[model samples]
Structures are given as structure tokens and as C-alpha cells.
Target: MGNNLWKDTWLMTVRNIKTTLRNPFSFIPNLIISAFFLLVYEGGLSGISQLPTFEGANYLAFILPVSIVSAAIGGAGGAGQSIVKDIENGFFSRLLLTPASRLAIVLGPIIAGMLQLVVQTLLIIGIAFLLGLEVVTGFGGILFVLLIAVGWGLAFAGYSAGVALRTGNAQAAQAGTFIFFPLIFLSTTFVPYDLIEAQWLKIAATINPTTYIFESMRTALIDGWVFWDLMQGVFAILIVCTITITFAAVSAKKAVSRG
Candidate 1:
């Protein structure tokens, strides 16, 4: 059963990737937006690093992880959109009639999202390097950041896939993803936690999972390995994945029942 599940998941993931490749329109816009954010923020906020409280002189390094994480999570909707398309076109129902594992039916798109997140992250990191950003932890740091970013993105991809399974509506699934935009911005996206003056915003950022994730990525990129922060980030990912993946599994079961 485990081997069959893995086999089905691999097949679905491959199909999802090919489907996404054939439709550049689905994923290209997110990359463009992420690139634009990296360029614009690095240029406009170059002065921020000079602030007394800021960690490094290179603003791009400080902000590059934000761009990577944003790009990864922003594109997570592609998985759900694919599921919605499958449902709308009757493919999902036909798929339900097969011997494929239902869990893999839900997980396949999410695993595809994880692979896509890695690609997008590496591309963003490459662009940052071209713009003079350097990681203190070097290649190992890059791998660490990618792992964190992909893990966090997996949680979100699960949320997106859950919405798609529950609603089977592209618009609804897309709308669900938009809810994360504020979560990104409300966190310490623009400044360090200590630098935030607004009490409510501070409270929000303190509670926001993105804040810890960002700090973990920033630590790896600029501050070397900080065990506590990295662990906090890992914990955040696990917490989110627990909730969202469970939601996805329940939604998938419901989808199968209705299908």
C-alpha cells in the first residue's frame, strides 16, 4: 500500500509539473512579481541596512529571503488551481474511479508545489547574488533557507489544495490564497521585530508565523547558524503543516465522497 501510494503520488506530481509547464500563464506572473519585489525593495530600502538597529550593510541580503518566501507561497495557488481545473473538467471524478490512493490524489499537487518552490527560490537567490547579495553561511545556508521556505510553502500549499478540494471552484481557491498576503505584510517583512514601534503591529508580528520563518531565513543568510531561531522556524512549519495538511486530507476525503 505504501509503495502504491508513493507510485501514484510520483505520477500525479509529474503530471502536475508537466501541466504547469505547458501553461506558463499559471506560474509566470508570480515569479515576475517576486522579481519585481526583490529589485524594488533592494533599491528603495538600501538605506535601511545603515540604520543602527539593522544587522547588515547589505539590504538585499536582509530582504532576499522575504522575496523568496513570498514568491514560493504566492505561487502555491497553482496547485489548487490545477485541482480546480481537474474537477471542473471532470478529470477528478474519472480519477476517483481508478485504483489510485486518495491521499496521493491530495498530496501530489502539494509535492509539485514544493518542487516549484525550490526552483523559484534558487532563481531568486541567483538574482540576489547577481545584485551583490552574499550569504554568510554560503551554499549550506542556501540549502537551509530553501528547506525552510519549502516547508512553510508546503503548509500553505496544503491550505490551497484544501480549499480547492472543498469548493472545487477556481475563484474560491484563488480567493483563499489572497488571505495570506496580509499575513506576509503584517509580519516583520519591512523591519526587525525590535525596530517595529507600533504596539498592535508588534503584537501581530510576534504572533505571526512568517516572522519566525523570516528570521530563520535571515539568520542563515546573514547571521550564520542560530540554533534557537532555526528551531522556532522549524516548529512553526510543523505547527502549520499539522493544521493545513490535516485540513487537506479531510477535504480530499470529502471530495472523493462527493465525486
Candidate 2:
């Protein structure tokens, strides 16, 4: 049974990739938007580093992880939209009629989304390098950041997938995008935590998981590797992923049943 489920998952993933390639217009727009933000942030606001906590380094390094997260979140939103489109077109219903596991069906699109996000991240990082952004931690730090970004992508994708499955509407599924942006911007992604003066934003940043993620990436990239800080970020992401994936699985089951 486990083997069959694994095989079904692989097949579903392949199908999802094929669909994504066939409908590139649906996903490419989000990638372009994310790339635009990455460029603007790196080029326009990087000079802000001369202000305070960011003085010792270029602000592009600080903002890189945030850009990665943004890319992942945007890609997940697009994937959720694709899921909603499939539902609307009755393709999701046809898939449900097969013996494939509902969890596999839900995860397939998310996996494809994450793959796209990874490609976007690589491209962005290359662009940053071309713009004279230096990676202090070198290859190891880059690998670590990529892993964490992908983990966060999967977690967010799972949550978005759940929303998509529940609503069966692209607009509703896309709403998850709004939920994360504030959480991400309010955190220590662009500026240091100590530099934040706004009471409300400070409060929000303290509770936002993105803060931990940024801290982890910061320590890995800017400073020497710190295991404890990295562990904290990893733990937070793992817990969130577990919860969100469970939610997605349940929602997918329900959607399959209803279909």
C-alpha cells in the first residue's frame, strides 16, 4: 500500500509539472512580478544599510532571504490558483475518480510550485551576484538558505493548498498571499529587530516566524554559523509544515469526496 501510494504521488507530480508547462501563462506572470520586486529591493533600497544596524554590510544580503520567501509565497499562490482552475474545469473531479490518494493530488501542485520557486531563487541569487552582492558564507550558506527557503515554501504551499481545496475558487485561494506579506514585512527581514520603532509592527514582528527565518539566514550569511539560531528557525518551519500539510490533506480528502 505504501509503495502504491508513493508511485501514485510520483505520477501525480509528473502530471502537475506537465500541466504547469502547458499553461505557462498562468504561472509566469507571478514569477515576473516577484523578480521585479527582487530587483527593486536590491537596487533601490539597498542603500538604506548606511543608516544603522545594516551599516556593516550591503542591504542586499539582508533582503535576499526575504525575496526568496516572497518568491515562494507568490509561486504557491499561483499554484493554488491553478488548483482552483482545475476544479472549475472539472479536471480535479476527473482526477478524484481515479484511485490516486487525495494527499498526493494536493501535494503534486505544491511540489511543482516549489520547484518553480527554487528556480526563481537561483535566478535571483545569480542576479544579486551580478549586481556585486557578496555572499560571505559562500557555498555552504547558500545551500542552507536554499533548504530553509524550500521548507518554508512547502509549508506555505500546504496552507495555500488547503485554502484552495476548501474554497474551490482562485480568488479565495489567492487570499493567503495577503496573510503572509504583512507578517514578512513586519519582521526583521529588511531591517534589524532593534531598529524597528513602530510599536505595532514591533509586536507583530516578535511573533512572526519570518523573523526567526531572517535571523537564521542572517547568522548563516553575515555572521559565522550559529547552530542554535538555525535550529530555532528549522523547528518553527517544521512545526508549521506539519500542521499545514495535515490541513491540506484533510481538505483534499474532502474535496475528493465531494467530487
Candidate 3:
């Protein structure tokens, strides 16, 4: 309700961005880890796409979404860790003393993490491009892919920020963020859900929301501008954000009360 509420959040986000840029090495690992998995999987699992289920599919295109998802997770996890550091170092306490919106403190990391993901997303996609993955949707599609990456990153950042405020524990926040990886794998990370032969894995993938996120990204990369996939991805992000950010915002409020 404050007139300058957004200004505070933007300044907070800028502060976090400067902190991240000061230590450039922190940003490098996310790109490296994503590229490593992309290359390693392309080398080892290229043949998997030859199966009847794949039926003329491109494996690199198939896994590009996976790589981007990994990149998003890494960036989101880093955001949470940085928030924990601030909380530990008493900077968060300093913020609590200001009339700045509590929402600003909670949202600053989400905005910074999303902005950081823009760079990481481009890195993952650039590597994919160098390795011979072509975007069927061309320039517009490329931008759309970036949007999907941001959505997922925003969702993850919300969850991470919530965990950081809830526990104020670095280890717990890291573990909480890492737990989302299992959901990624359980969804269609390595193979198509219909192509998966394992009954249990198939069932889990069927139920997992990330499967739709991957499907949306994959559809954008290969199938051009399909309205359904884009809509599905947006809705999935809404579900995740509604749960994570809502919880995170509430958790942040509670943390302030406790502080």
C-alpha cells in the first residue's frame, strides 16, 4: 500500500545483483553444471532417441529443457543460500528495522534470482545452439523459451526464499531446494513419459507438474508456437507460484514477527 513500496524492492534487488556480480565465480557453476549434464547425456544417450518411441526425434532438443531446468534450479538454490547468508550476517535484521515493506525483503531475492536466471538460461541455450540444437520457433520462440525458464526459476526462488526465512539454516535451505530435483527426474527428464516403460516411474511422471513444464519447453523448441503447451506451462507455473510464493510470503511475515 505504500507509494514507494516497489522502489525499495527494486533497490534491494539491485543490491543483491551487485553482491552476486562482485563474486563472478558463484554464477559460473550453474552454467557449468547444466552444460556438463547436457553434453554427458548427449554423448551417452543419443541412441535412446532412436527407439520406436522417439521415432525420428532429436535427443539434443529433447534434453535442452532438462538442461535449462537444471540451470534454473541451481540459480534458485543460490538465491536461497545468499538469503541465508544475509540472515546470518545480521543484514536481514537491519532491514527489519526499516519501514521498508516486508514484501520488499521477501521479493528482492526472487527478482534478483529471476534476473540472474536470464543469464544462466541464455548460457544453457547458447551451449545447446553450439552443439547443434536449432530452435524451430526462431527468434520469438527463443524469447518464449526464456520466459518459461524465468517462470520455473521464479517458482523455485519463492520456495527457496521461504525455506531460508523459515529455518534461517543454510543446510536445510539447500536440502529443501535439492529435493525439487527428484521431482524433475521423476517427471520426463531423461525420456518421454509415454515412452517410459517403468510402471511406477510412469505413474509418478503422470502426476508430476514438472512434466508439463518440460513438455511446454520441449513443445516450444520443436513444435513451434503451440498454444496448448504454452498455456499448460503458464498454468503449471501459476500452481507452483501460488503454493510457493504464498507460503514464502507468509513465512517471511512470520520470520519478521519472530525477529
Taken over the whole model, the C-alpha lDDT of each candidate is: 0.85, 0.78, 0.85
TM-scores for all predictions: 0.95, 0.91, 0.93
Off by over 4 Å in 1: 1-3
Which of the predicted structures, 1 or 3, would earn the higher lDDT when compared with the native? 1
Pairs in steric clash, model 3: none
Candidate 2: tens digits of C-alpha lDDT, residues 84-127 = 88898998888787777776777677778888778877876777
After superposing candidate 2 on the true structure, give the runs of residues whose Cα lies further than 4 Å from its correct spot. 1-3
lDDT accuracy of residue 90 in candidate 1: 94
Per-candidate Cα RMSD to the true structure, in Å, reads 1.8, 2.3, 2.0
- State the lDDT of candidate 3 residue by residue for 32-68, as single tens digits: 9899989999989989989888767789989988889
lDDT of 2 at 197: 84
Angstrom error at residue 196, model 2: 1.0
| Tens-place lDDT digits, model 1, residues 1-259 | 4449989999999999999899988878888888888999988988988898884447888888789888889667678888999998998888788888887877788888788888888898899989988888889999999889888888888889899999999889878988777768888887788889899999999888888898899888888888997788899999999998899888988999854
